[model samples]
Target: MSPLVQPRLINGPYDDPGLILDFRHARRAILFDLGDNHALSARELTRVSHVFVSHAHMDHFGGFDRLLRLSLHRDGPLSLSGPPGFIERVEHRIRSYTWNLLDERSADCVLAVAEFDGTALIRAARFPARRAFAREDATPPDLRPGLVHDEAALFIASAALDHGIPSLAFRLQERMRVNVHRDGLAALGLPVGPWLNVAKAAVREGAADDTPIVIGEASIPLGRIREHALAVGPGQSVAYVVDALGSPANEAAILDLARNADQIFIEAAFLDEDRDIAAARRHLTAGQAGRLARRAGVRRMTPLHHSPRYLDRPDALRLEAEAAFGSEP
Candidate 1:
């Protein structure tokens, strides 16, 4: 079967932790943890409307400024989500920069920041903060396991885990399903046109009616129109996890979020030989990261957020992780 989702490692141990997932067929795209994002050009950045940050670590957040700067006057609103202190961190970034250029620009951009704090959620915004902005806490929502953001087709879910501090793992799922049977359409002497829109609306709303679907003045029963387009397909899911120590207490929570992910991006800062150092620093060794991936039963695991010390020996680190996961290359 053709893969429903495609993931490109924008930047990683080879550079910074940036991944671009092309949900083109699903009518959306997602960027996970904006590290050095040179992999994505200005054109690609403009197309992405949703970004998920794993934590505030420089490698993970450094490219955010550039992303915001590039998309300053774009068409749609940008939605950013992360663990606690995310809103404050973003506001601090905006305040630290000069905004004269933003003010003069024609783009009226709005930043919506969502932060998860276990039982409650907080959200706020800054219009390219012109002055020294103080962090304001907004009304919190119940942070339970369900759809957090429900846009037209995009849905997001999050769960909190301890990383010496509050850290979060986010999953973005596209709930729109598109299906059509070519043979069925051919047999019915129906030419596919805008009638698909009515069928799609019915599917999305889960209701069917006897309304006549007029295609260029030709009428067709909604029930017959539904037959050619009614089919159920699987949705796509991508998970991002970073900077959490692999602990028994945190393992379940992390795995529960990562299990069965089509593409899982996790951190592997140390090798198994340095397990002690990893434990002391609250980072995961390559082996530990692989074990977690195996436990979560993910399809593909990309290990990132490497310590600079292993910069010259990245292959060694990668192999160590692959070995732990019983995978080669």
Candidate 2:
């Protein structure tokens, strides 16, 4: 069956961390971090309508200018969600640039920025790219614990982690997974088109089975299509975590937010031998990352964000993590 979201690491374990989640059958995409994303092509960058930032740390947020530059002419508003001070930081970034030249042209870009204090949205702002990126306080929706952003296809959840400051670990979960039966469609001589996407949306939105589906000149019942042409199941979920300390509170929060996630992309900034250093620096050791994954009951785990000191022996970190997860490396 086709997965609802395809997740790919934007950079390697030792490089700055970032993840791009591409919706399987849509033009939209979600960006987990803004870190050194130079590797992503312009087309891929343009597809990112929502960017979820862990924090404003330089390594995790340095790519914001590049994203802003590439998406300036995109059709829709770009939304940025992050931990506290996010709105002010976004405004500051925009204020650093002069937009006098943009006054003559039509405004085409709008930015929606939201700041989260833990799981609550404390502030929000919006601005048009052509208006010098001016800030306008916007009324945000009623706060929901752990929910960062909600959409028809999926929703994002986050937990505050300690990195000497508030760094967020995120999860992206699809509402449901709907698989179209290609063989059945071929057997019925029905050509697949945008209607299939509509059907998937209808299921996610909990539409009645008797809902009508338009195909060519005929209207068909969704129940008939389900009986002959579709398979439905639980959707995909992926959690991203990095630069967090291995404290009890942080561990508990991470475990709760990432429980039973299909895959977890977590930081392993140090080997077990450097546990003290890792603790002092507010980062996780490989063993700690694996332990968290095991405790969280994640189906799969990838350890990332290795320290530059381990450049010559990066495999050691993975080995340590594997051992801690009760798997031989």
lDDT of each: 0.70, 0.87
lDDT of 2 by residue, 143-187 (tens): 468789887767888888999999999999877888889897787
TM-score of 1: 0.82
- Candidate 2 local distance difference test against the native: 0.87
Most accurate candidate by lDDT: 2
Q: Estimate, for each residue in 107-142, the C-alpha lDDT of model 1 and write its tens digit.
A: 656666776664345665544222222344445344
